[model samples]
Target: MAHADWSDPTPAAGWTIAHQIAHLAAADTNVLIAVRTPEAFDAVLKRTEAAGSRHADLEAAAGAAKPRSVLLDEWRSGRAEVAAALRDLPTEHGFPWYGSQLTATLMAPLRLMEVWAHGQDVFDAVCAARRPTDRLRQIATLGVIGRELSFHAAELPLTTEPFRVELAGSDGRTWTWGPADAEQRVEGGALDFCLRVTRRRYPAETDLTAVGGDAQAWLDNARVFL
Candidate 1:
């Protein structure tokens, strides 16, 4: 994913343009570090959870640092640093994060989804609409991530059948991920789908649809880590 301009020119009420950018940067930095070092990441996660007590606070703190200008610069610099780190990572090298081991290469796509999804929160907070690109690749990847997480969180058996997830972009293009003949299907706009699984946007706020048993349950608690 290319770098998006961190500007909300005509932002609505509640937050300035800078706050949104800073928020994304803060989260990008944390995930970047976690993917790089498993032990350190796990320790940090435990410590943070202990400090916050509530999961909401933990999520909030990860992206709630103030002073929008500093946040913007930090986001730019941090993304560059993580991008370089990802370039150096070998395919075979794996790091444990959120209770799963993932290859280093997957970090880029994962972080891309994270930045895009959380960035949407800032957008909604500012009341601006954005038509996302043909990012089907990233959206599909995120669907898989969400599927795995939803299953793990619910402690449900992974269904033998596959799922078909389709997201229609703003340009009237369809981006489909997963299987067609599966136990479940979640379909909606790419941006809305991303937001829904990310838990940043509630089902009522987006056009997402969930079919089959446990699909809604899965979406309810989807996360990178519990």
Candidate 2:
């Protein structure tokens, strides 16, 4: 990634590779604040909201002021700080995130999802092929749990019935969610499902198979990020 062209645009619309890394760095800094100082995190949220500025906008502005090397250094340092904070925090501690709260355990996977998703943008910018890994199970699980949020985010009706998801992991093992006897089912590759749910790839572009109305609806509206 260091050797890649930071100014090059990625598949994520108007964002460049440097913007993606900067976004992650900013997000990691926010997470660190959320975990270490609740008041500061609240201030950050308030300031961003008051300015009607999204985190991405703030990140891009910040990134534009610095060179790629500085952004890379901040990103690396911010990640290490967040990691250490999460490691030292109690398991029961829940911090505000987006509009809700998450425990240390839950926050870790969300961070991983961001890293993997943004990493995809970087890879795409450089014309690199990204291989699926067992770690994607974390993202897949998050996507499944975000089913209701997906519907809510899209302002659609939330289905009461639970759907089963069976993804063929890169490790050649099936990662299953919900009940096996569920009426609605989603079956596909883990990477495809992750990308679809993250909105990195649309359902029509992926090989995922949805077996019922609810499952199909989920695929249509799935979003891992809140």
Candidate 3:
């Protein structure tokens, strides 16, 4: 893409295409820090806390100010560092993250969802098409796992009521969660479900079907990220 192409606006409020990629790079760096050293992670956390809610926007803007090639290279470097750190993480340990903690196993899918969700914004902004990948299963899995967290974030009461989710995969297969006989059911294409789960796309914009009010409300507030 041309340098000017980086200025393209995405669906995320107040974020240009460059900002989206920059956010990923910053997030990758934070993940690397968290995985490698809890002490360094806490220092980074203090810096972000001082910025209040603007920390993410500020980080993205800083990276977005760099040249496209520089930004891309930095992102690549940070991603590789995070990948290695995650692989080397001890099995019995979890890392501090945004006032919570996550094991390497869970953190990996969360990062994947973050990248894919932001990548979707870029694709939508440029009107580019992307083929659905098998990796979407990981995202959907994260969505399923994060349902309770999202519900709490949305101020919805926690309910143990199980909800079934059925997705038609791009690879000509059906991926499902919960019991087949569950009353609350969500059905949709895997891509659509992934998009909605990340809040990159609304339920109405996708082919998702919610069989119960609770299920519909879950879709309305779906978000895999903190």
The prediction achieving the highest TM-score against the true structure is 2
lDDT of 1: 0.64
Q: Where is the poorest 10-residue window by lDDT in model 3?
A: 1-10
For the record, the alpha-carbon RMSD of candidate 2 to the native fold, in angstroms, is 1.3
When summed lDDT is taken over every stretch of 10 residues in candidate 2, the lowest stretch is: 53-62
Q: What are the C-alpha RMSDs, in order, of all predicted structures?
A: 5.2, 1.3, 1.5
- Which should have the higher lDDT, number 1 or number 3? 3
lDDT of 3 by residue, 81-120 (tens): 8888888888657888988898888888888889888998
Instruction: Give candidate 3's error at residue 98 in angstroms.
Output: 1.1
Clash counts per candidate, in order, are: 0, 0, 0
Q: What pairs collide in candidate 3? A: none
Local distance difference test, candidate 2: 0.87
lDDT of 3: 0.88
* Residues 1-226, model 1: lDDT tens digits: 1233434432323333454555556556666766665567877678666866454444444443455455656878998987887778787678666656777577777778767765666566556677767664675566657677678777887766677777787678887767777768877787776666666666788887788766665666555434
